[model samples]
Target: MGAMNTKVIEAEYDYVKPASLDEALDILAEKENVKIYAGGTDLLVKLKMGADLGMDIMMDINGIEDLYGVDKTADGGLRIGAAEKIWNLETNADVIAMYPILSEAMHLMASVSVRNMATIGGNFCNASPVADTVGPCMCYGACVELKSKKGVRTVDATEFFLKPGVTVMEADEILTAIILPAPEENTGAAFTKMARVRPDIAKVSISCVIKRDGDAIKDCRMAMGSVAPKPLFLGDISAELAGKKMSAALIEETAQKVHDFVKPIGDHGTTAEYRKEMAHLIAKEILEKAWENSGGELA
Candidate 1:
């Protein structure tokens, strides 16, 4: 193989690896053109792929004490530290049992080795159109906690991504943690992805969360990845299916609605039309599986 024609820029930043969130935020506020480095799984790859390198300061937050644990809040929601690895999320028994959508999504990401180093925050912060975590996180109604030198703020996952490679995060704010609400009683969530290869990034991915009340659906949330510029919530279809008994016809109808709502563009991985078709198929499959797991009728 020959050397690729990619520009290499020399590192010019004063590296600061902060041990605390406050310290990291302070550095961010004080430094000019500072970029936060988490696992660097995505950032480093983008840089190698010839992404623009414009930062003069690189602040490493992986060692920050305030952003390195997985615990439950007093209200019983899971609080995942921003620095927690995707592999840890895949294997965590509590996360597996309670947030199967997240577990499945994490398991479907790159590979075991990559997941071992990729943090959830990095996945969301990178804001890739096909990010595995975004779909599941949106379906679960997860919120991102961001901190700056002044204070902290939280934003829902559904609203985090503004466009491909863009988020609501400000330059001086670091994502501190991800907050996932506890699953409701009699609820189940599932995620499905389609790719040409087992470990490749998803061409189209869907995550469904359903809550059952007797034979009827009490709530349903569906999110799709890689089918739009950013992760999208299928709110219209969700509302249409709410309070309805699960059925093949209803599932197919809602799936079509979701398919119609998504606006995908042709890319190297897959065609736009193929993604549209897969989006419908994957959404139906995940919704049906979630309904069945939650003790709802599948017929």
Candidate 2:
């Protein structure tokens, strides 16, 4: 009689820490099976939980010098180096004042210690069902710049997610940076989340950006998290309010539309109906707060 092998794979085959993006891409292209490690917050935890035991190699990109800073683009947009930690983005005054929605979303992420070690790139790459940054970034019209040995390509954050824990990133591609367009003049954004407690993953979250022209709503963008396979945009609802004067009735109508747009599934943390209702309430509240912050106009 012959016995079958029962040993389980417990760790990675090889590890490499590359000092440059080009070097990393070369390794990724040559390696048969490799995973990129960024902040290591999400990846490490998943590894420890036996999530990636089949991964044969790990390529650590944390040492790449070019991917660790925050800079402004020539077009007045903000370019966030992929390796920039969430804590830095949350506390940096320039980011806070310019992209308040991003700052707010970062602050609402995991605990302070996790935020210090978590990179924005890692957050997007992890592709969690309810990733906090995805909704806000999508609403703000952010794009991710991915680099590979072949070349570089940009993908809008809204289209980045294909499904839960899935993105458009190719095997040899690495996300290099996130680019956020500057908010329009007379524009403001607000993010609202409902969780069981502080530091808890959001049960549902909503982000809204509104631009005002005099006393009328000029444009609006709205997004929601934890309500679908990925974060969702309420463009239909936003379009309906364009050029309309902001009022309590208008806000409530928009909120109801948002409520109808989400198709949340029941999960451990919340019921689908609860999430739908909360999303409506939060969307309305955020719109009101953003309107007030924009000086009762549409800033």
Candidate 3:
């Protein structure tokens, strides 16, 4: 499917570049069989494969200045605009310092060239189960802002994706921004992935965020990707680990919980059983790294 498809993208669709969110929403509200064009990294590939053959209206919202940058919310969280490039997130000093897990995920995603052309919002809207950003975003307590002709609503990352290549987004909705809560003073986060290769889809990936109070885990959150239908958040497992002293035994128990909780599908890169196993391993590893970063020692 790579280069064999010779379809030209512009041949079938009427294009519109809306300069304002109001104009875009008006178009979306009025149009049927329309597709929102962001970075087009995944959209273009899907188009070439004829996945969206019936799509006749291509609404290019990239020109909307309101959806274009990362800013700080008054509540000490990050508001990442929908059209901000992946390359920007990877190299942005504020993003790197405050949200290193997001930076790590971005670094491990597609290639540098693809990242240059991909947007954070496009990645989420593409809704691939193995989307590298979703895992870390979930762990970081992120939410997405969706807008339509009606109004704007915020949805947590955990509740955003309905299934593979699907989301809670309505046909007329556009994801305007992603909001990430600032990490607490004692919190630390880490992300790890077991992919077939650097630039390929992850076989299994996990992100962990933990807050420590002296020697105990004060709070914890974990999210895993590519091992299930969508990125799975292990809130139960996180709760079990919280308030407990960090140790190899506790880590193993939590890892086992993760292994028991997920039901992964088998694919070329790994078997279902192997995916579950790696989920355990990577969960433990990332949790430990997060603990250590929060000033715990591996004893």
Candidate 4:
């Protein structure tokens, strides 16, 4: 519910804007209840709602030079600095050209103004069930790089979020970058979102990346959001469909399976039943689109 109808933050915390990643990590290692602040889109709202975060330090990593770059990785994959704003990704020529699915997802995000302030890392770290970008990230076979003074480790994007308002990242670990594997040749991807309003929080969303093998499905990654505590990566569904020939019957059957697998709650701007059904419908739509985009006609 609404904590109060106020615009002021009720919590007490020290704000730290570090100029480098090492400086940021050092602050985190020494502090407790260190909330990594970015964009301040969601965090500020919660604080204004009078949520007691028990905050000790608000570490702003935007000033950190190492946490702000977009470059191609060694394997031709893309490495996106965690602090990149969502709006920038939407307009990045390389990102738009190479991963149109992500571009589409970005466009469907909040209004242009909010997107300007929201960082990509902040969105994932926020760990909202209705987060629009998480499913697309998982579908692209992405990983999140986490760094602490102890060392650095990578967590698969699909595995990062443990629950709402929680991630596998420790209090001291910082999300350094998002590593996205290069899309295989002849592969196509698709994304769809359902919300009460355009550019609003998603009620239900799905994304898929498909590598086509002639008329058969060579491989695929599928995921959905707003239907679970964390984004649901359909590894089982993808495994089951891999190597299977594409057909209307197969798509219809998979949709039924999706509806059965999802466990959405009846809240967040829609009914559980509605989200469940939309998940099924979206799966079918994206399956066909991705297949067609990969230069094959769905039979």
What are the per-model C-alpha RMSD values against the true structure? 2.1, 4.0, 1.8, 1.2
Task: Give the alpha-carbon lDDT of every model.
Answer: 0.85, 0.84, 0.88, 0.87
Residue-wise C-alpha lDDT for candidate 2, range 1-299, written one tens digit per residue: 12322253356468889878889989988876788777788877766656644678888888698788888888888999998999999998878888898899999898999998899999898888688887778877899999989999999998888888889999888899999997778887899889989788999998888888878888888888888987777778888888999998889888888888788999886899999889889988999987776666433
Write model 4 residue lDDT over 1-299, tens digit each, in one string: 45486666767888888888888889889878888888999988988888888888888877688888889999988999999999999899878877888889989998999999998898888999878878889988999999999999999998898888888989889998999988788898999998878967888899998898988999988999889988889899888989999888988898888889999998845898898889889989988888888887866
Looking at candidate 3, the ten consecutive residues that score lowest on lDDT are: 1-10
Q: Which of 2 and 3 is ahead in TM-score?
A: 3
Over 1-299, each residue of candidate 1 has an lDDT whose tens digit, in order, gives 24444465344556778877778878888877887788888877765665666777777887677887888888888999999999998899888887887988898899888999999999999999889998888888899999987798999998899998899998889998999998889997888888889889888888888999988889999988888888887777887878888789888888888888898999995899998888888878888898988888776
Clashing pairs in 3: none
lDDT of 3 by residue, 1-299 (tens): 34455457534789899989999999999989888888899888878766644788888878799898888888888899989999999899878988898999999988999998999999999988889998889988999999999999999999998888889999999999999997788888999999767998789999999999988889999998987788788878898877888888898888888989999999875899999889889988998899988788766
Stretches of candidate 1 off by over 4 Å are 1-11
Candidate 4's displacement at residue 246, Å, is 0.8
Which pairs clash inside model 1? none
Model 2: weakest 10-residue lDDT segment is: 1-10
Cα lDDT for residue 23, candidate 2: 92
Rank by lDDT, descending? 3, 4, 1, 2
lDDT of 3 at 103: 96
Error of 3 at 291 (Å): 0.5
TM-score between model 4 and native: 0.97
Judge candidate 1 at residue 168 and give its lDDT: 95
Residue 211, candidate 2: Cα error in Å is: 0.8
Winner on lDDT between 1 and 4 is 4
